[model samples]
Each structure stands twice: as C-alpha cells, then as structure tokens.
Target: MFNGLSFEKLLLVGVIAVFLLGPDKLPSYAAKLGRLVRTLRDYANGAKVRMKEEMGPEFDDVDWKKLDPRQYDPRRIIREALLDDAPAAAVPVIKPVSRPEPAYLSRQKDAVPSQAHDDSATPFDSEST
Candidate 1:
C-alpha cells in the first residue's frame, strides 16, 4: 500500500526502472519484489500471531492507539500533571530557609569598602594601564 507515493511518482519510478533494468529483466525483478513483499507480510503476520498467543485475550482488548509512542507529548503530560484537581491544602508548602553567606563571598564583601558616598577620584595604576 504505497500511501505516501502519488500516482505520478509511481509512474516516474516505473519509467526509471524500465530504463535501468530493461524490459527483458523487469518481469523477473518484479516477481522477486512481489515475493519479497509477500514474505515480509507473512513474517509480520507471524509476529502478530506470536504476540497474541503470548499476551492471551487481553491483547484484543488493548487500546493500541493509546499505547502508540507517537501519541505521547511531554508538554501535554506535564500540563495534565500540573492541572490535576488535587486540593491546594493537601500540597506541602516549601519554605526557603535563610542561609549564612559563604565565607569567601563574605570576606570579599568585607574587603571591598563602600564607595557610594565618596566623592574622591578613583586611584588608577599607570603601569597596569
């Protein structure tokens, strides 16, 4: 079932194949392709049958569309989780604990003198410049 291929595209591919393979060998190649498709179909059917046997009757009841990985959207899942109808009171409130500043940061702050109120010109190192 070439669902993705348009009629024009199929025609173009067939024309190209005819030119490349020639009319003499085309029939044999087409037969081989048909057999390959048939074999693949049989293999898929066998796998399905094996899965059905291993899973039992519940396999028939399974929501295959719902189980599809393509149907999962992380954004939708997170939104659903965030908008769940659990009572606000039941949710624990996390309070941020006041922590003492790190020793290095405290020392740095202590080392730097406040210059906000100072009107004096800043001293510059001529050698560094």
Candidate 2:
C-alpha cells in the first residue's frame, strides 16, 4: 500500500517528528494521527456500503477493469471503427459519377458558350475551366 515510501524514509520522518515535536508531545500527536486514520477508514467504508446499497446487487457484477479510464485510447477506438470482420465480397462498390462533356471543349473557339456554362447554376469543376 505504501509503494511511494520505503521503510527507511518512514523511519527518517519519525525521527524528524520526534525532534521537532519533542518527546513529551509525540505520544499525543501519534494518538491524534491514529484517530484521524481510523476516522478516514470508517468514512471510506461507510461510503462504499452506501454505494453498494444504492446500486443494488448488479453493482457487484460489473466489470470494474473494463470501466477503468486508463483503458481508453482514441487511436484504438478509431482503428476498431475503421476495421470490419466481413469478407471483401460482402462490401459494396461505389462507381464514379459520369457527366456529359461541355460543348465549349468540343467546339471551335469562336462558338458561343452553352447555357449550361453561362448559367450561374452550373456546378463548379476544378479540373476544367
């Protein structure tokens, strides 16, 4: 439980506390610290019990590891979304759109522009003017 602190560090802290507080006040401080820890543990237990009671028996059946925030990865989620287990033949093929050639391109330069090219309603074409 004390993964961040080793026994040596704890012993050093205790020795420092003894010197700072003096021997007379150390015992009372230790008692207060113990009570604080006990109270915190009681509160935590009470909260857990209350939560269990409110959530019903289904709470115990939940997969806690699956719900952990550390398991979330945007890259993995997007990769899964783009991938599928179905065979290639099961997927649909989308053909490109075919449009009639504009009259201006096939006719002489002196020829008048067609209504389709002159009209503001004409769709934009990036490859051709």
Candidate 3:
C-alpha cells in the first residue's frame, strides 16, 4: 500500500525515529528488535510445520501457482458440510436386544452370608490378625 512512498520519505521517517530515540540507543534497540523479529518468525514457522504434520501430506497441496488471495475464505471450503441433502454415510447400526433375566440371579443375590462378607476379613483387610 505504501509502494508510492519515495526514498526521501523513508529517510525522513528514519531521521525522526533516530532523533527521538538518540544514536547511541539505536544499535542496541535494533539488536533487540532483530531478536524479537527472529523469535516471532521462528514461532510462525514452527506452527506451520506442526499444522502440516497434523494435516498430513495433503496439507502441502496448495496451488501456489493459481492461488487467488481475494477468494481464500475458509468457510467457503466447508460450505457443503451443512447441506440438507448430505448423504447418510454408511455405518454398522447395532440393534440392542432386551435380554431376559437369568433364572439363577435371585439365588446368587441371596447366597452371600453377612458374616462371611465382612470387609475387614479379606486379603485387602485393614484389621487382619
């Protein structure tokens, strides 16, 4: 957007900033700025790498040769996911059976003696003799 700005205009901006911050502080300030920029660039590159890893090989399938920045809305890519006629994808629909109660259930439930069921007398007992 600032392509029309002349070299003189950039020189003026640099002069003003140097005057405001002073010459001695500029080198140290520039070193810190360079480090900050490197950190941010590294962070962005790491994120891009991680996204490529997570998305698999298809992540690099960008058509850089034909990419149009103006039409790059993410929502446009998923526009058909919510369609009314979206296909009913095939799946194994397990039919649950209403199982009848086992005939021995009542007998098993009443068989455990109260004295033999004391929690302190088992191998996990806290009150072992």
lDDT of each: 0.84, 0.83, 0.76
Better of 1 and 2 by TM-score: 1
**By lDDT, who's the top model here?**
1
Instruction: Return the TM-score for each candidate structure.
Output: 0.62, 0.57, 0.45
lDDT string, candidate 2, 12-58, tens digits: 99999999999999999999999999999999999989989999998
What's the best-to-worst order under lDDT? 1, 2, 3
Q: What is the lDDT of residue 103 in candidate 1?
A: 59
Error of 1 at 58 (Å): 0.8
Off by more than 4 A, model 3 = 1-7, 64-129
In model 2, which regions exceed 4 Å deviation?
Answer: 70-90, 96-129
Tens-digit lDDT track for model 1 on 1-129?
Answer: 568999999899999999999999999999999999999999999999999999999999999999899989999999999999876676678998786766545655666576232436564443353
Alpha carbon lDDT of residue 51, candidate 1? 98
Q: Where does the lowest 10-residue lDDT sum fall in candidate 1?
A: 115-124
